[model samples]
Target chain A: MTIRTTLSAGLAAMSLTATLGASTALADPVTVGLITTLSGGGAGLGVDIRDGFQLALSMSGSDAIHLVVEDDAQRPEQAVQIADRMIQSERAQILTGIVWSNLAMAVVPSATAQDVIYVSPNAGPSQLAGAGCTPNYFNAAYQNDTMHEASGAYANVLGYENTFIMAPNYPAGIDALTGFKRYFEGSLAGELFTQLGQTDFAAEIAQIRASGADSIFIFEPGGMGISFMRQYAQSGIDLPIISAAFSFSQDVLPAVGDSALGVINTAEWSPDMDNAANQAFVAGFQEAYGRLPSVYAAQAFDSANLILSALAAADINDLPAFRTAMRAADFDSVRGAFRFGNNQHPIQNYYAREVVSVDGVLTNRMVGTAFEDHQDVYATDCAME
Target chain B: MTAALFLEQVLNGLQLGLMLFLMSAGLTLVFGVMGLINLAHGSLYMIGAFFCAAAAAASGNFWLGLIAGTAAAAAAGALIEVTVLRRLYDRDHLDQVLATFALILVLSELTKIGFGPFPLFLDVPPILSGTVNLGIAHYPLYRLALIGFGLAVALGLWLLIARTRLGIRIRAGENDREMIAALGVNIRALYTLVFALGAGLAGLAGALVGAVQSVQVGMGEPVLILAFVVIVIGGIGSIKGAMVGALMVGVIDTMGRFLLPRLFGHFMEQSQAAGIGAALASMLIYVLMAAVLVIRPKGLFPAHA
Candidate 1:
């Protein structure tokens, strides 16, 4: 990933020098401008996306494809700055990668406005799935809230009547909360919205203890989820925690330990998934990276696969045909199957999963398929004709 | 709301406040004495969490992990103070900020390299894991323990500052540096020890928090920012200030997040209420800090001698 980033950085640096200090600038490669939070706490996902994309490129025999990767450093406005340079200056036709919904929102509109194709690897903002959906914007991932909504349905089926929801105060949080409520026929005893990236959830958990919330549905991802889950388990409530997919993914499974054992999560990807593409992707990813692939990797792989198949079927150099072919490609997804929605987001299945023992080792696996091609609630607002 | 529900929320808020105090007291002390704004203090907190998780996992004992995690932070802090920060005492805040920011990158990456990018979990001891019925509501025993633990640290800090030679030296350092150095205090060692002590406090907070949370790279930063806010409101370098600031911030934050949306709901749509309430709740601490700054400039409990 660093190699690709450095190579992109090298290209960008060269182009920058040429733009400022030359007339002999001739060798400008296909610059794929990438923006994501590559620093701060969320850097975990950012690094994974960066490395996953680079690995795909490497496996496909390309690095000088000129990826002008820039770190938002987890800052939203900074992402805009990087996007601007990538478009006007780097002459990038395609923009790829964003880890945060806020950052994605910042970069995607700008990319689409310039008629540039933006391939989103991480954040699938509900706005993009609905009224804000655009032909120029393509999500290589599931909408943010679909996975949690799936969890909610499973929990509802399991007979959890009172569920409490907590999430960071951000657009993605709202999406996840909405999703949970959609399928979770239970009464929300209370919903706690916190600052994005908040470390402590003790106060909220304590409040929940008294709320008589039979089940807790939380959507905190990354380090925050780890803290909340461990604490929740430590709280000795014994309430089943139906979680959004990101909360207990590969990135955090080990961190949360045995406490994460019964954590039923909902997501589109899991290593133990019963599918040929997924099996292949998991094995290959582990072999290549020396660790199991998280959902982010699967999402990136599918995105690249879609891109490859689209480029192959249509005139690779023709932008309009490429976009049309991609929209119609119905590419082989690792998540069994999915199709692009009219809004350029995916109408895909979400799964109900639990961390179960695989050969005496614990890891999350799919228990049941929950929501089928679940559309975002905000899709109604997405005014794309 | 029922009395139990309200009582539970208050306890929850205090637990949150104590956790904040654990981080902010050290931060405020460091700021008061050194005038260095460390953006990477969170990294040290993360270190403690990672260490505690690893130690507890390796030892199968939560207490040992807690101690080891605290020690690990102290050692790391001492090392950083000696190797990196010692050179920066003469530099400006921008330089200090940049250097510490870079340290965050190095430390987070280093943690990733060491621990592998998977999140690590620490288990609460069985005895501490159960919940207690507080007359009206069931609350986690561990959270109550955290509040107790935080109080112990606060009292311990107060006693140390008021009754010990080292504490007096630290107080002296906060007031005058050259005079203290002239008085034959090993100012260098004092700084290292103080930094390490502060780091240890941050680490203890990390380890304590780790039992409830996932331990991963860059886990300490959000708490670190809030810690800064705590100290800023409490007055830099004052332990009492940190306590008051932490409690105020935690209670306000907790209540605002819980009640503000409902309050706003009375005047607006549900979604709009939630959005406005959540945003306001998160920003409320900062708003409070700004207000205090406007009135007092030096914060509520200024550390000035």
Candidate 2:
């Protein structure tokens, strides 16, 4: 995997200087512009995405592809600027590698409007799944609410009578709580929304201790997750924490350590998941990156493979053929048995994962399937042709 | 809220304040003595955390890691002062700001290279890992220790500034750099020492806090912002002001988060209340800062006055 990545890096470097007309000699080389949060708070997720995407490209040994990567810095305006540059200057036919829902909302509309194929590896905002869905856009990841919704259902399965749900006060956070409440059969003991990038959780912890909630479902991802889990553990509150995989995946669990042990999270993929595509992606990612692949990496690997399969079927310059090929979703996904809904979002299974101490290191292992072949509820609202 | 819960919240506020104090002390001192707006102060805090996490993991001893982290940060601070900052002592604040901001980017990237993009865990030492019975609420022993340690540092700092020769020199240097230099004090050495001292405080705070939070890249920027607020509210050059400002900011922030939602819940739906409450809670500190600015433009405890 490392050797392949190195070779791809060499190819990518060579392509940087390679003129537009140079690649047209054989066939029109597809330029994929990947704009994601490569710096700031949630950089780990973006890094994983890029690595996963590159790994798949390298493994496929595709020469008819040119990858252009840029950092969005987790800002909407910056993402817009990058999207414009990629579309107008880089002549990228397909745009991917958006990590956050808000940034995706900002860039996807404009990119798809201009006839660029927007394939999302992550950040499946509900709007895109519903009324905002476009024929030019395909979400290789699950909808924004799917994981949280599944976790809420799993909480019911665990017989939780009263659960406290908390998330940051952003669009994603609102979606998280709304999703959790949709399938959560239990009475909500409390609903809390914290400041984005908030590092302290003492006040919230104190409140949760008093609220008498049987379970806590928190959607604080990345650094926020690390702080909350550590503080929650320090607070000596032992309530079961059911979470979305954004906070509990391999990217975050190492930092969360023992505090996150025994916690359950819901996601579309895990490293230890049993499947051929998943096994290859996980092993390849580990060998390349020397770390366990998070679900972000798994989804990104799938996205790249989707692109490859689509490219194999049709030329990127031919919009109708490319769209049809992409719609077919011929790629073998790490999540297994994947297909796109009418809305172009994934119809995939969500799994329950438990954070356990494996060989003295914190990692998530698949516990059970939460929702089988779960198609997002918002897909019905999409009127895309 | 129950008395125990309130007490715990207050303690949490103090713990937060003390952590801010550690960060602000270095920044305030640097500004007061050198008239430099060093934005890279947060990078030093991050350096401490990464060092602490790495050392702790390598040594399997938290104490050794803490010492190493603090010392490394101080050394790095001293090195930067000698190499880069000494040249900027005579430059304007804007130049200092730009240079320091660049330093922040460099340090953050370098730290990311040394440590991977992922966060590192710093476990709470076994002795500080349990809970203490506070009658109505059980508080974490680790947090209590953090507050206690911060207080000790504050007292020690007060003594160092008020009682020690170096402290007197620092204060004197703050008052009149030319006079101190004319009086035979090596201004360059004093500046280096003070810079190193400030870095050590920031580093110590980072090491302590890293146990409670994940040690990751860009961890220091938020704390650095709060520390700036601390110094601004406290009066930039004053240690007493930093302490007061930190406590005030900490309590207000914490209590706002805890009480605001409940306050809004009386008038609206829970979800709406949560959304509005959280929005207001985040803005509470800045509102306090604005109010304070309106009342006293120079801050509550001006070091000079």
The DockQ scores of all candidates, in the order shown, are: 0.51, 0.74
Query: What is the Cα-based lDDT of residue A309 in candidate 1?
Result: 69
Candidate 1 lDDT over residue span A291-318, tens digit each: 6677787777777667666755665357
| lDDT string, candidate 1, B35-110, tens digits | 7777878988989988988999899999999999999999999999999999999899999999999999899988
**How far off is residue A382 in model 2, in Å?**
1.8
Model 1 scores a C-alpha lDDT of 0.80
CAPRI-style quality class for the chain A–B interface of candidate 2: medium
DockQ of 1: 0.51
RMSD of each: 6.8, 6.6
lDDT of 2 by residue, A56-82 (tens): 999888876789999997899999999
Which portions of model 1 miss their true places by more than 4 Å? A1-34, A51-70, A84-92, A152-156, A159-161, A182-186, A373-385, B90-95, B133-137, B259-276, B290-297
Q: lDDT (0-100) at residue A190 of candidate 2?
A: 93
TM-score of each: 0.86, 0.95
Worst 10 residues of 1 chain B by lDDT: B112-121
Pairs of colliding residues, candidate 2: none
Give the per-residue Cα lDDT of candidate 1 at B72: 96
